[model samples]
Target: MSIPLAVVAGASGFVGQHVVEALRRQGSEVRTIGRGSVADATWDDPGAIEQVLAGADLLVNLAGRSVSCRYGRRNADEILRSRIGTTAALGRALANVGSPDLLWINASTGTIYRDARDRPMGEVDGDIGSGFSVEVARAWERELWDAPADVRRIALRMTIVLGAGGGAMSPLINLARIGFGGAMGDGGQKVSWVHVDDVVGAILHLHRHPEISGPVNVVAPDVVTNAELMAQVRGSMGRRVGLPEPRWLLEAGARIIRTEAELVLKSRWVAADVLHESGYEFSHPTLASALAEIAGRAPRGLLPVALG
Candidate 1:
């Protein structure tokens, strides 16, 4: 028996770093691809990418620009280009040197599903949404599936990932501390979220279960409404008061912050049917549990501060 080789692209991002550490802890040799000097291969050089990918047992591509910006013309174009271009590039590389034994897990978003307050969106029955974000998600997955590689591929349609140190938790914690932790807009939109630990766990689980392929929703089964989410945020931080923001105010604040309100306003009722059916037990299955663990790891005074 020999150690496995895992090649991870975009290894500098928050999630990517965790994935790399997890793989290394499991005794797998890790290679990274990015624009950074730490990367074994840069995206600019297709030859180097192919070389690094060759003979690797696993390939995880988390390459994509952050969508945490206002969707202006320039940012929107780069968002789409970053995702589709990197995915297509990997596809080309894999076509040249891929094998049936290799497994490619590409990053995707659960936002591809329509904003549904009516029902939960599953992989099989979820309705694809419209708009810029949805289009980007669609194109990102399309590029992955259209690849001519002989290897198995899984488009990880992840939802809002919460964790300590980085991710959506920081901003939310800030909002709570500032006394704006109340619900956004109507506060009825369903939020489908997963802990970062579960994201890593699901990836390893998928790698082990070769039978699971195609688009898989990497989210927790428990979904919470916007109001419920905010309430939990306040509780975790020991905040006594939280002022709710209406849609109009949210739009204004979004412009001020250079981020979109859809990030919080949209109803994302996603169901992890595949993970559930496939028996992937989530470590933080509920929003309460997830937030508690995340708050525990956060810096002192950042959470559980003196209530105001």
Candidate 2:
């Protein structure tokens, strides 16, 4: 049997790398397009995009600047431009193609939902937030929605993705190792998250389920609070205690790290309603089990120093 051809934009990213590997593992011929790779065509070249789309059975756009930094004006502009611009560019290329790809799965974020400490948000009834990150997500989705109807499109509103290498888990792991993985702020904010394996599985499921379209929350059914999340990290790392970070301290540290406190402060209570109804089973549903799987063994040799 011949393998399907997949064109993945921004496969170099943390999630994208895993997606590409998953595709290839499932017997798909994957071609990556990025600015850094001379072998692949760059996003600027409309001809390159159309060429890839023409032959591709799937088109996955994960191209965007990381939003893990302080949002100054210049940084904010780049963030918006990287997401919205790349999405628009891909739409134009898809339009020019002879036949649109079977499906286009563009990356979105669960942060698009408001800070709901009360209830879980889903695609049908989730409240969208305002400001830079929310605005970027809104506009990014618009680009995919406005694209030609020939291709089926689904915007994956992903939550905090946990894995071995990167995505939102690394820094937290490092912080735990150094004995600083504790609750931030009031520790009441909901932490909606998913394991990387589930992330890959969700993408594959979405690809197969042509009946599903639009925004779907890709998160584990098991949700945790900031306190519970840190507790799990501490337990996995074989630590007894962690120093809690107050809101003022969190704000100060974020400024020093050149990142935004909103990354830590905001409450993201999202649920995988679409995936649940689709009957997709999650491999690592609980936070503790997922952390243990990622850790693999007993974590030893702590720094003996703690951070506030």
lDDT winner among the candidates? 1
TM-score of every candidate relative to the true structure: 0.96, 0.94
Question: Which 10 successive residues of model 1 have the least lDDT summed?
Answer: 299-308
Error of 2 at 237 (Å): 0.5
Worst 10 residues of 2 by lDDT: 299-308
Give the backbone clash total of model 2.
2
lDDT of 1: 0.90
The C-alpha RMSD in Å for every predicted model, in order, reads 3.4, 3.1
Q: What lDDT tens digits, residue by residue, belong to model 2 across residues 1-308?
A: 23398888998888889998989998998988888864277887889877877778788889998898878888898999998888888888878784554788899999999998999999899999887889889999998999764788899999999987667776787678777888999999999999989988998888778799889999998899999999999888777788889999999988887888898889999999999999999999899779988888424443222221
Model 1, 135-167: lDDT tens digits are 999999999999989899999999999999887
- Residue 42 of candidate 2: its Cα lDDT? 89
What are the Cα lDDT values of the candidates?
0.90, 0.85
RMSD of 2: 3.1
Native-vs-model 2 lDDT? 0.85
